[model samples]
Target: MKQNKLIGLGVATMAAFLLLSVNTAEAARTDMVDVSNHNGYMNVSDWTGMRDKYGVKSMVTKISEGTFYKDYTAANNIATAKQAGIYQNGYHFARYKTAAQAESEANYAATLAKQDGLPNNAVLVTDVEAAEQQYTPLTTNDYNNFIFMSTVQKYGYRTDIYTSGSWMNNIMTVKPGTGWIASYPYVVGDKQWYTGNHAWQFSSTQNFAGTTAVGNFDVSQLNDDFYTGGQNTKPVNPVTPPVTNNNQVANQDYAQTGTFTANTTVNVRSGVANNAPIVATYAPGQSLNYNHIYIVNGVVKGRYTSYSGQTRYASMGYIPGGSFGKRSAVSNSRTYTVRYGDSFWSIANRLGINMNSLAAKNGKTINSIIYPNQQLMY
Candidate 1:
C-alpha cells in the first residue's frame, strides 16, 4: 500500500512539470524585437550587428522634416538594411505647421517612396513632436491628423503614429492606423504607455544579447501582420482614368485626390489639356492631384507634367459646384482642423457627426478633399 501511494505522488509531480515546460516554451516563442531610429543618426554597421546578434526584426528609420533636420538618412539606411535582409520602415518627424503642411509632407514622402521602390515590408510612420520652437497649434489638430494618416493609407502604404505616451493621450485624440509608443520607465514596475501598439520602445539604451547604445527594443511579428492587415481587409477601389490624348494613363486605380494648401514649387507640365500634369513644387497648403482633372474657368484642364512626374487634375466644378448648395442636414454640425495623424471618418466620429453629412458639408464624397487648416463643416 505504501509503495503504491508513493508511485501515485511521483506520477502527479511528473505531470505538473511537463505542463509547466510546455507553457514556458509557448511564452518564449512569442518574444520578438523591434527597433527604431530616434537618435540623430544610426551607424549602418551597428544596426546590422544588432539584428544579427539579438534577432532584431523590424526597424523604423527617420526620414526628412520641415525643421532643421532637413534630410532623412532613412533612404540610405533602408537600402543598406534591405541588403542585409532586415525589414525596413520609413518615418517622418512631423513638424506640425498646419493640416495642409502635414498632408504635403506625407504626400511628398509617399512620392519619394514610390520613386525609390519601397521594400515589400516597408511602412510609413509619422513622428509627432512639438519640441521645436517655431510651432503653431491648429484648432482641429486631431481632424487634420486623420486626413494625413488616411492620405498615406490611400497610397497603398501601411501607416502608424509615433508619439510620447502623454502626448498621445492628451494633446492628440486621433486614433492612428497603428501606434509606436515611446515611454521611458524610471522604475522597474512602471506601467506601459501603449497597450495596443504594435511596437514599443521601452528604454533608450538596453543591452540585449551583448549589444548596447539606445538599442533596447522589441518586435511583434504579430504586429507586422496587423500593419499590413488592411491590404486584405479593404476591397480595392477602382479610379476612373480621365480621358486624355497626349499622355497615356497607365493606372488611375492608385490615384489619390486632396486639396493642396501649401505653395512649394511644383512641376507644371507642358502637353495635355484639362488633365495636364502641372508638376508645381508647392508651399504649405496648395491643392494638388485633383483626381487627374484641374478646373480653370469651370472647365476640366487636361493632363500636365511636373518635375516629379505626371499628375492628373480634378476640376473644382466637380467639388459641390458652389458653397450655396443645401448644407448637409445631418444630426450634428461641426468643423475640424488638421493634425499629424487624422482621417476624415475619424474626425466625423469624434465630433458625433454623421460621416456622410460631414463629407457632403465639405463639398466632397467620403474620400474627397480636406487639406490641413481647412475647415470641414458638418
Candidate 2:
C-alpha cells in the first residue's frame, strides 16, 4: 500500500478485460484486505486467520493522514476487525489537493472514523494514491465535487476511491460504478477484467496461505455490495473529538522536573499509549532526565526512570518553540516538509533537530524514506 506500484501494460490489460471477473471462470469476486501501520498487530486470531483462510469478506482500515497523522494502528485495527467478525472500513491516506484541503482532510478522516471504531455507515476510504495526488491531479471535480462531498455532506461516511489503474483511467474523473482500482496483473486469471470500480486491487502480494498472518497481504476483488449495500447504512455522523480525551492522560497541566531531550529517536514507552511497550530507544541527542510530565492529548509525556527500575514514557515533543518542559534548541536553519505521517524519526521530531542532524541536513540517512511533498533540511 506504500506507493502502490505497477501501472501501464496496455492500461493494465484494458483494466483486466474492462473490470469484473475475478478468475475461477466468472462469478467469483468477494475477498478484501487493505490494512495500514503497515499491517502489524492483527490479532483476533489474525482476523480469524484472514477469515478462515481467505474468503476475507472485508477490511479497509488505515483511518487517518494529512490533517496531521493519526493511525497508531487505528484503534487496534478497528477493534481487531470487530472481533473477527470482519466487515471493517475506513481509509484516508490522501493528502488533499484543495477545497480547503478537502475540508481539512474531511475533518481528519471523519474524526479518525469517530475516534477509531468506524461503524455507523462504515466505508470511509479516499486513499487516492498519493504522490500528493499525483501532483495536484485530482479531477473528476475533485472526486465528485470536493472529496466525495466532504466525506458525504460533512461526515456521514461511505465514500470510496483508492486509485491507480492508471489513476483510474488517466487521473481521476472516476465515477462510473465507483472507485477502488489498483491493478497488478501478472496473472489475475489471465484476462477478462472490467471496472466501473467496486474494487480491484489484484494483489500487492497476497499470502493468506501463510495463515496466522505472516506478511504478503493487500489482495482485493470485492463487489457483491462490497461491505453490505444500501449505500453502506448512513445515519450516524456526529464527529467531535479534537480532544475530549483522545490518547488520554491529560490532567497534569502543572508538573515539575524538566531537562528532556530526544527530539527524534524517541520511543521510551511501556506506557503513554500508542500501544506502549518499547521500554527504551532515545538516540537523537538523547537525554530524557524527567521526573514526571504528562499532558498527553496535546502531547508532551516524559516520566523517566528505567535502568531496569522501570517507570518509563519519553516523548517530549510538540511544544513548537519552547516552554512546556523546555525543548527549544532547534535551528540548523530549520526547514521541513515531508508530511503524511513522516519519518526520519518524524522529521527529527518535527525539526527540533538531530536525527543525525536531520539525516545530515537532508542528504538523507537515518534510514531515509521520506515522501509526501518531500523537502527536509534542518
Candidate 3:
C-alpha cells in the first residue's frame, strides 16, 4: 500500500507541471508592427505577407504628428490592414509638454483618427519619445491624463503610451501607462522587456522571415490588451461606397448640402477615386456650392455639375497636404478694418463670410477699390 501511494503522488505532481507549461505557452507574446508614412503605402499583400509569413497579428498606424501634420497614408493603412485580417489601432506623435497643449493635441489626434476610420474601441496611443520633451519635460502624468481622458470622454476610445526605456527610467517622473514599452536588446528570440507592460517593442530593425519588405521594421511583442482584446469593436462613421456600374458612382450614401470654401487650392476630381481625372480646382478662399457629398473609401467627396453638364467631385476633407476646405459658417457678428493688400475676396475668405454680403454691408462693389483702414461690417 505504501508503494501505491508513492506512485499516485508522483503522477499528480507530473500532471500539475504539464498544465503549468501549457498555460505559459498559451500566454506567449504575439508579434505586431507599428507603421507610419516612413513605411510608405502598405497594400493588402504587404499586410498579408507580414501576417502569414512573420506572424504579425496587429498594427499600430501613425495618425497625426503634433498639431499641424496628418499622416496621409494612415487611411489606406487601416483599410488594407483590415482587409488582411490584422487588428488596427493608431498613435499620435505627441508634442505636448503642458496640460493645455496636451488637450489640444488630443483633440487633433482624435479628430484625425475618426476621419481616418480608426475604430472606437481600438487604442489611441500618444508617442512621447520626442527630444523636445527632454529639454522641456512634463513634470507629471496629469498632462498625459489630459490626452487620455479627452479621447475617452469626447471620442470614446481608450489611450495608451509608447516611449523608449531611457525615458521610462530616467526622464518620466511617473511611468506613462501599462502600454507598449520599447527597448532594443539587439538579441534574438522572445525576450522579456519592461515590467507590468502589455506590449514591448523589442526591435526597431527586425527583419521578419520571408518578408519582401526591403528595410528593417519596428516590431513588438503583445501579451494582451494590445489589439483591443483582439478585435476592433466599433467602426466610427464608416462611409460606404455608392452603388456603381463601371466605376461611375450613381448615388451618394446621404444627401448633404453645404458650401465648402477652399482654404487652399485643391483638386476637383471626376470621381471619388484618388486617381480620378482633375476636372477643376479651387483656389484659396474660392467657394464651391455642392449639392451633395459622400464619404467613400475614406475620402469625403462633394458633387457639383460642371458647365459642360458633367458631375464633378470635390474632396472637402483631408488629403495628403491638408484638408481641402471646411464648411463655411460665420458664428458671430464682427467688424473688420481693411489692411494693406486686402480685397473683398481676400477679406471674405479670411473672415469666412460672403464676399457679396461684405460688399453690400460696406456700400461697395467687389470691383471697388478701398483704401487701408476702411471699416467694414460683416
Can you write out model 3's per-residue Cα lDDT over 252-272, one digit (the tens) per residue?
Answer: 355665567876566788886
Per-residue lDDT of model 1, residues 1-378, tens digit only: 100111111111101111111112111111123333434345555455455333344555655554335334456666766665556676666665577877887887666666555654367777665543113343455655666677777778777776655566465653643676555445312244455666544443343322222543333322334444332212111111233345433221223333333222233444324345544433334444233333332232323222123343422211101110111112334345655455677776655557887787777888875666776674
The prediction achieving the highest TM-score against the true structure is: 3
Ordered list by TM-score, greatest first: 3, 1, 2
Task: Give the least accurate 10-residue stretch of model 3, judged by summed lDDT.
Answer: 13-22
How do the residues 21-84 of candidate 2 rate in per-residue lDDT, one tens digit apiece? 1122232233678788777768777667555433466788787777888878878888988887
Q: What TM-score should be assigned to candidate 1?
A: 0.43
Pairs that collide in candidate 3 are: none
> What overall lDDT goes with each candidate model?
0.45, 0.60, 0.63
Residue 355 lDDT (model 3) = 96
Segments of candidate 2 deviating more than 4 angstroms: 1-50, 55-58, 61-77, 80-82, 85-89, 92-103, 108-110, 118-125, 129-161, 172-181, 184-187, 190-200, 203-378
| TM-score for each predicted model, relative to the true structure | 0.43, 0.25, 0.51
RMSD of each: 26.7, 21.7, 23.5
Error of 1 at 294 (Å): 70
